[model samples]
Target: MDRPRRCVLLKFGELALKGRNRPRFVNALERNLRRMTADLGPIEVRHRGGVFIVSGDMPQEELAERCLGLPGVSVVQPALRCERDATAAADAAVELLRELPGHTFAVRATRRDKRFALRSIELARLLGDAVRVRLGLDVDLSNPDLELFVEVDHKELLVSVERLRGAGGLPVGTSGRALVLLSGGLDSPVAAYRMMKRGLRCDFVHFSGRPFTSPESIYKAYALVGRLDRFQGDSRLYVVTFGPAQRRLATAGAGRLQVLSQRRLMVRVAAALGERLDAGALVTGDSLGQVASQTLPNLAVVEEAAQLPLLRPLIDRDKSEIVDAARALGTYDISILPDEDCCQLFTSKPASTRGHPDDLRRIERTADIEELVEQLAESAELFHPTLEERAMVSAATPASRGPSLG
Candidate 1:
């Protein structure tokens, strides 16, 4: 075996403040991280001195790639995670700068263990002072050419400056579960992301158009959510074919009414899925009046069927703002993939901008909406994101599956 060119270190940040619930939270985080990086190498997760360390045959750069996006992680700087001598420490610091674009930099050390006779400030100054004399560098604290931070733990040491970008929230499965209405569009996935950032575990309810609609669009939406789960860790998605119902309503002279009717059915389906799956609410991308179907009056008609709380995380956000957030979280590229969602099935005249709930109920009675619901419920496919492959596939695929809600 080519000797494992891997790096070992601990992750700490917000978990420090967590009291009794700390172990439960870290266990969930460590599990998710291992799942995401499993294929790359045999990654190991351990708890030490109020932090979790992952070690194995994985490079610091590649391992850092997936570790940064994990929730509950605050700092991910490189570490030795083992005992070190002064020569080793000094050599590591010097070697770090040797491949630099410039030669002028300093090393700052902090000794928390106190086993080292040289005090923290004393050791830091000497490291900097020695580097200045040996490498002809300048010591600039406020605005240094570069900074080498050495954090010494009991038996190990970490040396590096490539800081990891954490998800900066509580771990997944911490807050309660919620069902996300994932569309291939930009807003819904962004909505799911914002909620996940707040520690809300999510199960996506995707309404796809099948038989009448091509499989590509549904695949595109699944792919989008999967990308996020790769960043997040474990997420489940339910793919329900609502096309026959949507088509039936359209053919029944309800083209103008199809959008609202389908939405009510979506809410109804989500409510049942939530009940079965322990999800607390239904989250959507329905921004107020963003489109004809999302208008204030139309929105009310769409939401009339739901007994559960409807979470519109992006309700007040402008499209531009949602798009910016999506791009930052790496969802924008997949959201624009080559496919169309069920929403593209109709282009009605005037498109019912101002809808009345009572009228919607009357239409539902006349249109036999229960039949639509029956067809939709029977066709639903429960899909969870595959964290191992780092990609989304149909639930039927042998992949890294999650809890089944059926």
Candidate 2:
């Protein structure tokens, strides 16, 4: 047998059905798996029996944690499994279960290893019965305090009792890097998750309309990113102060174009930062024709501000879709937190549904938005990932040194 740390099995859902797209998704997942682990160490991925098995001497749990947005992967699990010889497999299960915290137990088996000659139910019962005798614990088949799960693959039978909740998306950094125009809004984070599911590495460039708004908003925004950063790599934040920029642009008679102008500036800031961050595009969590600002005309005006490609993963999506995604990605709770962001600052009464590029171009003629942008960017706060030593997230940075308030 190989060393104990030799292999970790990565099982995927949703990607299995697409016969042709499957390969591309697999390739993307592999690339992301590597990028997220660039700081970790070496690892190898092998494809067998429709599941990807990762082998390495590095931290399997850490690698698994970093793989929240890995494309094509539904879940990531680290475990040891072998041929389904009931007596032997049960013995291994018993040993592993003993290492966990609590003990009232049960074993669940999913038999796809036909050669084992036992139904999944029977296999589970046999293993459960064996563990009960070995560990001297009573079994509550309905729901034992501790569950030992046995998943039977074609070539191997995997045994694991505990599963960690993963970021539960595609691998981060697989699709390409994208600088998300992350407003501290409920929708944008969810949108970022949608894009990440396709394998995009995301870094946030948050725009703060400071002075007009308090730093508390930026704190809220970064707090939201902290939750997201758990799945993405290192959770880096680039804060851009839009206060002076917005004031200058607005004083120059940029009223109807205020929102559009602000968005353009944000796009420009994100583009510049994206280059520095090695990101490929800009992502916004806007739904199609939902808000007055999101109307086709308004969206076109705002999008023109960015030189790089713009990705609106949530553009065509609905509120239900956004909420569902938010809830599923685990950003829902924090997003609903009572923290205010820049968007709430200028809640325009009767906001614009149609914005003309001509108006934006006209505004560009007066106020030097770019110069203000430069000044703000220069004065911006920079942060780095609180690098950890172990594969598992033993600890994270304290909230004190985290991203500053708006």
Q: Which candidate tops TM-score? A: 1
List ranges where model 2 is wrong by over 4 Å: 1-9, 13-72, 75-156, 159-170, 344-348, 385-401, 404-406
* Candidate 2 TM-score to native: 0.67
The residue pairs that clash in candidate 1, if any, are 79-158, 80-157, 82-156, 236-384, 237-383
Top-lDDT structure, candidate number? 1
- State model 2's lDDT: 0.70
Q: Worst 10-residue stretch by lDDT in candidate 1?
A: 397-406
Write the residue-wise lDDT of candidate 1 on 172-197 in tens digits.
77777888888877899888877876
Candidate 1 — what's its lDDT? Answer: 0.71
- Give lDDT tens digits, candidate 2, residues 180-279: 8778767888877777777787888778777777665465466667766645557677888777677777777777667777788788777877877788
lDDT of each: 0.71, 0.70
